[model samples]
Target: MPDEPKRIVEAFSQELHAAYHKAGVRSYEAFAARSTKINRAMHSDTGKHTFVSRSAAYKTLTGKRERLPTWDQVAQFVRVFRAEAADRGIAPDSVGTMEQWKAKYEAASARFWAAKKAAASRIPAMAAAVPAAFSDGPQTWWRAYADVVPAWSERYLNHEPLSHRITSYEPVYVPGLLQTPEYAAAVIRLGHGDEPEERIARRVELRMLRQRHLERVGERPCMWAIINEGALRDGPVGGETMRAQIRHLRSLGRHVQVQVIPAGHPAHDATDGPITLLRFPSSQFQDLVFLEHADSALYPSSEEDLAHYLHAVQKLGLAALMPDPSRTLLRRLEAEI
Candidate 1:
């Protein structure tokens, strides 16, 4: 009878955890609330013990008396829970086994997480304990890339307003931020294929937003894109669009530098793939190298890795026209087109 109850308790615990995970509820309070609601579906709210109670808590995540999915059904629903919890600073390990609960009636983890949040809010004065940017120490091997971008942007955006440089080699088309509306729309339609109208709108809208990084007028990314003479002739988006794009690239030199790798050159290495390298004011770190494929993108921030990209850029730039001559070439293209 004891083992039967234990087997039943295990099923309930798994069900309770499953509901928490399925609801996309990462915090304890959210999990507890979801568990309680589902528990009530099978029986009245048994409160903390509702999950363990043999009479309550449905086998399904929704707390529905029927439609209780098997354990296999639960896996797919909770797929995002583990990663989602890690992001929100919750641990899967904290949710213990049910046998421990029978030994000592600890409060439901979901409820406990909620209670802590409420308690923290009550003492507003103490809530300012953590600084805007929390760092483990002066140095750490692992810093999230998401944190690096904002912090680096904030520090370098102004001080090195002149020094921040981006030398890009785009093989496919104009870089997203520099692209014209017509070209952007053309590219999106080709890529999305049968994507819904809303999806197409979002892709265009996101590109337009990226354009603002350059459109800020005063302090902006000094983007220097080098295209093969072939790029000048390729014209995937077609002539009228290419004319606008090439002319736009030419016009940008008035505000920011533009360079064209002369088309007549026999062959070159930079044309092999597109590589974007960005420099920062802080000498503590080397320049950042961003590599982009069709759908995926990566920013390499480490010094050794960045140095390799920088050397490649140096060698590549040697093969391209200087800023002034590059501008002159762009002007000539405008006149010819």
Candidate 2:
């Protein structure tokens, strides 16, 4: 029988493939040559040389084989890629050290097996794409997914340097980038009521910092946000707070193209859920979809998952009020508030 697809392995494989591409190691011959050089520098293993054939390297990237690549094989790829990145003066923390690469490899391996186990116990298709981590599901599953990912804030917001495009659908509230300080504070306070005031303040500060990406000097991220009308209407965060937030959204119209999904839009794609799709300029780094939950965020790796969310965004865009009309709606909402 053929092996089932594992999103964890596929995701890691893409990252590894991207590392090689960024290093300008295109052909299998060149990759193997670099591997040999790195192996010689690290050790004097005359008998056991680092050798990965063209077919094997291709299989690793394509995720065609049943077994995951060995750690030593992954290490060789990482070292060569890191050295190339250094030559170009690029220092990404994701692949900065051997230990980091190893940790990621191990985590991905563990997740693959876990998915397989879940498939065996439940249904075979459960292992198809690792089930969405933050989809509407049990809290235990969500927590388990969150525990596996770290520095999520960094992963979500630090795409500033990548020159990517961001399209977000916000059904409940205004996006962080267009939120006013007072509005942000009120929302945070309500959500994290038990947290200390100082901690909440720090959290708010970090969120504001992430918003800086929108104001970058050259080639800032192209942002398109579609907000639901309910978010504007159902607000008890004090009239002044909501009013200011609406005005802030209007001001952000200068940079971000904001749209309003008027209340009772018959074609509301967000009725199911919301998603943020990120597209990169480089072909090496695949498009990403970010699903934000109450306490955790999800990065879906499957192409099917990505397509579903991207299609939702397109439908929302079609149903949304025009940009000029969206600003007009915001102004009208502000006056009512």
Candidate 3:
């Protein structure tokens, strides 16, 4: 079976192309000429005729244009195709009767207009809702909530939900997606010491909400986190909070694949700071590398920079303990705590 069309326009184009070929019309230029002649005869009484240009016909037939042709244009093309097919002893039904073509055109036209309107309205709505800090650029919707989520992480948040797999290397703290509520609150409080308690609480709430992407019923992204053993041993939160955090990591065994790099391991790549690599399901979007810093974040756009981070993360994965052994290490740490 043929794959489904990715967009409504493509589906509508396929229908037109199939009908055009069924009528034995080969050249778009020839079809345009025929359509023009028929349109002239149909509107001759009014002395105002519609001519179909080759470029317009080509776009409509090939689905290269953003918007569908007007209804009159579509009707003219149908009449032209039917007339040509009848000349060759072809039945109108074989080339798609007017009623059949009309139904297809109306359905596709309605969907196209609805989608266009929604797209037109979304820009203003998004612009109005976004804060001034994020209004300067596109895809900065996450900036409105910058107080709760770090403003520097706007780009990362945009891609997180769309990623099919996420690989992260953290040398100082647990990856946010794997962190427990207590661990997250402690980390937030320590990082933003000047912030009020209520603000800190909201930050923790945002972190918990972000973690939900991993808990989706289906199509949840695969999470592979490699944490330095020191992060687990020398964490900000300790005592029962630390122990519960360790326990939480263990319980996530079924959902997350966790690895730990032992202390005293040889110096290696990704030692500078945390690295998060996001891979999308579709090839249309390039894989992204997110490097988080104290007050800012960087998304390396150059191919060379992306390649460097990709290699570093791969090396970190190899140096870290394997999944089963990593869980064993987590168990020992929980007991020690």
Candidate 4:
């Protein structure tokens, strides 16, 4: 990873730090303590147990652990499972050195299943429990994230369709979250002339870490970032690298949404400068907006602002090609070689 600070980490990290605030934790320690619960779950519940320790695990995994659920979460989970285990008197290990504990649980479960199969005369019983409801629509999902975004990050090891959709307009350069490593490092060195070597490395790592949201859990929402025609033609990373990056954007359009609004076209709301829009697909309206300037970024969520951004997106969709045409344009651009 390059040593430049990546916007992805900065964005998620800030959201996490704020989550601790609602949990009634204002201090850094309190925030970090609650935050680590996310890392803990990755190791145990999701089965990424190769992670043996946590002292510096934060550094290695972008603070995402291959850890297990906390006792509180596990306890609640067990209650739901216990009824299924039923009169068979099935019990799960509550204490463990981890490796030994896993083996014991598996062995016991296997024996329980075999014994049940042998005793056909035993009283018939319902075995499966009601599955948990994970709502599919936007409001349910966004509320779940907004109520406790960081906490959700802990429990959910996969992608999340956030409370809002972030759309950025770029006239100057590619957004850092989408930049290639070599281009990013060049940009960072240009911006942070005196940043230490170690600092740069950490920043690059953090940036790469943030990109996971794009395809990690198969749930990250679509992105619609309109580029200025000049940005496409200038080859900011030099002809070859910029061409590669442009091709990358074209490829993304296959999966998400991306369009280029020619510079000569009539200016629209996004013309003043680059801005980001994050909208939610809630059955209800819980839409949000984020705008960034040279030195500051703000989330504007009042209904008035939300409506403005949504309207902007509606216009963008109108101006941009449908997915198929967008792919064709990209292929044409790539063929130009």
Candidate 5:
């Protein structure tokens, strides 16, 4: 029973492997290279391509990956196999039509997610049965700082470690994940003016620790930050502190992508407030939209709410400067300070 999801994923992998052989693809490396070539050729004008990594191919073909292949991945696999069959004078349909493979992939994906959901359903009860202090799980990390952080932020912290991708839009101060320690300390001091210095220091420490996720070797989540120009220019943090913060943002490297929306850009959909969207690796969990306010935060899960926030973020991305230009703007901001 515990292995149901694994069995379902493996069955799909077996089908994929059978199709690979039927298409006469010689090896996983060859399949990856051919798929990349085909994708580039098909989308040459747009300069768009999905390069299948050799590791990805090996994982998929061997059923070692825990999650189902994304639709784009499935489509790429089908196209690559079809191309190989055509070159060998074999009917592509003899290997497997795209429609047929899509159907199988969808069926397997549904069953796999269902199995995962069932397994996850037991977790809450299991956790309830165990004493919190004795249990050492992912939640422990957040639990350590719960006393210092606001109650409204609990949900976001809980999901932070589980997220594979995190996209955030900030119109005021720099996003927390990208804030430098000095900037973070200043922000914390301003927000909790009456709090003891010890508490503020702890909060700053928490924010800094949260950033360690970006430093993780391989499991780091992809972070996309869209910042308004006003946030950089008009924050309480200033002087060398702000300069250091800007430099920090500019130096985040590949794991973090930063985009800046110039001032006086056309009014956009996200004017209401800042938002964060967290996406997990598995389909069993729904993506989360976190809307934060001065004294409270809301986690909206309805389909309509999700669609609204998703659309807003998409538009915000378009309105923001491209990454290269954004980095240039950061450099200019840093120098001006």
Candidate 6:
């Protein structure tokens, strides 16, 4: 059994249920029977106990059980579910195989646990330092910290959609949502310089795919971005590429608002690095702030944390040139290049 953070466990369970439904397994009993068959076949000794009861399946999915299911059990679920999905003529290609799903599970668990540990220490420090009044009452914040945003971040963007407004401050590079393909490719290569070309290409593809939310139908969000002047001047991605990127940002118009801070602007509040705040319109989803570091990423939702970032953004805005002027600056930069 994998002892993972509650969020990863919940996501793992949700994946099982989703695959189960897609596989046309309507009841826990049926799913359990199918898994048992696979398990039994694999452990053909006949003396081994391979059967899992329907109650156990239910408990696993709902997280009611005290302990998690064994690794073998999860493998059985994945195997049976994939077979069933294939039988129903649903392409199982994207769903992935048992080993791939297991890899994803392990990755998700690692990310969750890493963030959990960081939050455990950071939250207390934040609480002690910030005013009590700034503490948002009993809020749960999902945090992640890493040099590059993980692949799993796309899931959050898709699941939450554009109804969740994204506000980001980039001190080094362009925000993913506003990046050009060439610019993104250059950035990804710089970060994953040692990785294979295929890996680098996939990273660029995913980054572009994440921008679809802007064009997605129904309740589009107003994405606002604050870019440092350094990100503009710090270009080595080629003059044509930089020109296209600046023009692309200028072209986003109302869909995305871009503000540029001049090179010498002295707003050190956001100098720590990139900061992102995901604000969802739905009451069920609380606003989240994403902070990334060299080694890890944090998703802190405490009132105090959110307030600090919000103020930082406000400071950034104060120091930034407004949209029109920013575009003018971009045009100037593009022309100079």
Q: Which stretches of candidate 3 lie over 4 Å from their true place?
A: 1-144, 267-270
In Å, residue 197's CA in model 5 sits off its true spot by 1.1
**lDDT score, candidate 3, position 130:** 34
How many pairs of residues collide in model 5?
0
**How would you encode candidate 2's per-residue C-alpha lDDT over 190-271 as one tens digit per residue?**
6677988876776677567667777888767888999887667654266677888888888773658999987757543234
Q: Rank the candidates by lDDT, best first.
A: 5, 3, 6, 2, 1, 4
| Index of the highest-lDDT prediction | 5
Tens digits of lDDT, candidate 6, 77-112: 777777777777877754568778788766765666
lDDT of 5 by residue, 1-337 (tens): 2599889978898888888899999887789779868865865554334434565677787887655666557788889999999989989998888899889977887787677667655534322432442222444576777778677576678667767899999866799989988899887776587989888888999998888877888888899999887677645565678889998998888889999987657532235368899887775567778877555555656566678888988899999999999999999988875
Clashing pairs in model 2, backbone N/Cα/C closer than 3 A? none
When 2 and 4 are scored with lDDT, the better candidate is 2
Query: Per-residue alpha-carbon lDDT of model 3 for 1-337, expressed as tens digits?
Result: 0122227777887888888888888687788678767755754454333445565567778876544555656777888789878877889778787888889888876776556445434323322433443232544535545766655577678768777889999976899998898889888876687988888888887788788889888887899899988678646565578789888989884658999987646422225468999877866556777877555555654566668888888888889999999989999988875
Model 2 misplaced regions, further than 4 Å: 1-154, 160-163, 268-270
lDDT of 4 by residue, 127-194 (tens): 11111232222334234334322331321212223423556666456665577776666555544549
Q: In angstroms, give how far residue 158 of model 4 lies from its true place.
A: 15
Clashes of 4: 20
Model 3 residue pairs with clashes: none
For candidate 6, the per-residue lDDT at 250 reads 82
Backbone clash pairs for candidate 1 read 28-110
Q: Sorted on TM-score, highest at the top, how do the candidates line up?
A: 5, 3, 6, 2, 1, 4
What TM-score, over all chains together, does every model reach? 0.48, 0.55, 0.57, 0.46, 0.58, 0.55
Residue 207 C-alpha lDDT in model 3: 83
Candidate 5 Cα outliers beyond 4 Å, as residue runs: 1-139, 268-270
